[model samples]
Target: MRAFIGMDFDKGLKDELNGIQKVLKINSKKGNWVPSSNFHITLKFLGDISEEQVDAIDRIIKSAVVNTSPLSITLDKLGYFNIRSNQYGVIWIGIKGEMMKLNAIYGIIEKEMKVIGFPKEKRKLTPHITLGRRVILDLPFSQLREQVDHELGKEFLLDNLTLMKSEEIMRKRVYTPIKSYKFNKILEKNHR
Candidate 1:
């Protein structure tokens, strides 16, 4: 099955990103825009794994997230990623605010999943919500980069992590949540 671990967005946050996508579409002439309902921030892309491996993955995820607290992530900043040889494959909104906490969660999942034979993440965890994917690679990115308005400044509480199944419907990719794991959010405020 095609699978991954990710978090869904709240309605208000989704609306904010939807607004961002609308703007991005207006500026760029070449890209496949992501559907509003498909908006999510992936924690790990597991690719294709067997059902048995998924069960094991679930165990690892549950253990890793135990005692983890909810975090507030603010989505701000617009950026594009280079896929290969000057091809900017994806445009995303960068995440900030409470990133250390979010990184802690990502690290726990990454480390524990590795123990169960999943390959370790090669790159540093860059938390962002994908907005659009490039269809044509020949366009000058610098011009398009300047055209996009990237500051989104939307914040929301993230309380659950989900293991998702990806499937294509009507030529568009759709994500279905297989299982949802709630963060046992610690309520203590740190005294500094």
Candidate 2:
């Protein structure tokens, strides 16, 4: 199955993201907007994997999150990766807060996944939640960017990391959780 590891957001965050997407949809000429139910922050994309590989990845997740506390993250800004000479792009929302902890979790998972034969990720992690793909704005990107407010939003905790399976069902992409690994150990108060 096609799979990945990611963090799911609470309903509140999903609602907030939906609101943002609604605004984006109004300003976009055309794009494949991500469904609110599909909103998540991908920690790693594992692509296609067999049942045996899923089992191995389960172990990796268990070890990676050991002694890790819940992560607190907030929305930082709206951003995009230009895909076709700036004519089209993938629109995304930037993330911030508890980034060090987020990176450490990713590092542990990446290192151990490599030991299990997965290739090392070529790009450094830039945490963001994808909002849309093949996106073309109604106005110039520079104008849209300057018009939007960029700042902190409500903070939320990612208490667990989920292993997600992706499938195209009835022409819509759906992500289902295969398993979730909770952060079993909390940091001492002094560590904060």
Candidate 3:
């Protein structure tokens, strides 16, 4: 199965992101806007693993996350990926507050998975919630960045991480949740 690990936003955050998407759509083409339901911050992408590995994958995730506390992420800034030209593969918001802790958790997952035989990703980790794809040319970069920044200044709490499955059906990819792990203990402690 094609799978990845990520943090899922609550419905309220999802709605807020959807609103940002609506505004971004004014200057963006149809293909450039990602469906709101697919919005997530990926921690690890484990591509096409065998069915025999499912149990091991679950164990790895549980072990990695069990001690990690829940993190609160604020979405700020609208951004895109491009080396040259305006070929935006992903439009996303930047993460803040507890980002380092979150990164540490992701590192643990990556380390544990590698120890168990999963291949490591070639790309460096950048935590951001993907807002859209397939961007058009001549984008109003300054305005979009401003809008993202304004929205991100508003804070949101994150309490859960999910293991998701990616499947292809009728030429489009669909994401389904396999399991969800809560960081209740992390949130219960005082933020000193």
Candidate 4:
């Protein structure tokens, strides 16, 4: 299954991002917007793995996240990926606050997965919500960036992490939550 772990956005935060999408849509090219429902900040992208490995991956994830407390993440910046000639890949929302803790969790997941024979990811973990893809126009990237920066200064609480399956739906990629794990401090306190 093609899977990964990520933090989902709350409804209020989704609405805030949708608002930014609306403004960018006015003068933006048709392919420049992503469905707001698909927005999420990925921690790890565990690509295709055998069915036999599913149980081990679950146990590893549970061990890594069981003790950490829920954190608040604010989506405050706008940026692009591989912006050389034109922004072809993504326009995204950036993250702030409690990022160190998030990075630590990602590191633990990467480390544990390596012990089980899964190859380490080649790219560094960059925490951002992908807003759109296949952008084909040279619309004022700077203006769009500035607008997103001004309007999307909202914060949301992240208390849970989910293991998600990414699948093709009518030729478009969609995510489905397979399992969700919550943080419990009492469990950690006892462990220490």
What are the TM-scores, per candidate, against the unseen true structure? 0.84, 0.90, 0.87, 0.87
| lDDT of each candidate versus the true structure | 0.78, 0.84, 0.76, 0.76
Off by over 4 Å in 2: 146-152, 185-192
Query: After superposition on all CA atoms, what RMSD does each candidate show versus the true structure?
Result: 4.8, 3.8, 3.6, 4.2
Q: Residue 48 deviation, candidate 4, in Å?
A: 1.1
Over 24-136, each residue of candidate 2 has an lDDT whose tens digit, in order, gives 78888889989999999998999999998988899888888778879888887888887695456788889899999999999998999999988989999999998899987
| The candidate that achieves the highest lDDT relative to the unseen native structure | 2
> Of the candidates shown, which would achieve the greatest TM-score relative to the real structure?
2
> How much does candidate 4 score in TM-score?
0.87
Candidate 1 achieves a global lDDT of: 0.78
The pairs that clash in candidate 2 are none
- In terms of lDDT, model 2 sits at 0.84
| Model 1, span 14-49: residue lDDT tens | 888888777667665567888989899899999888
**lDDT (Cα, tens digit) per residue for candidate 4, span 73-106:** 7876877787555645777778888888888888
Residue pairs that clash (backbone atoms under 3 angstroms), model 1: none
Look at candidate 4 and give me any clashing residue pairs. none
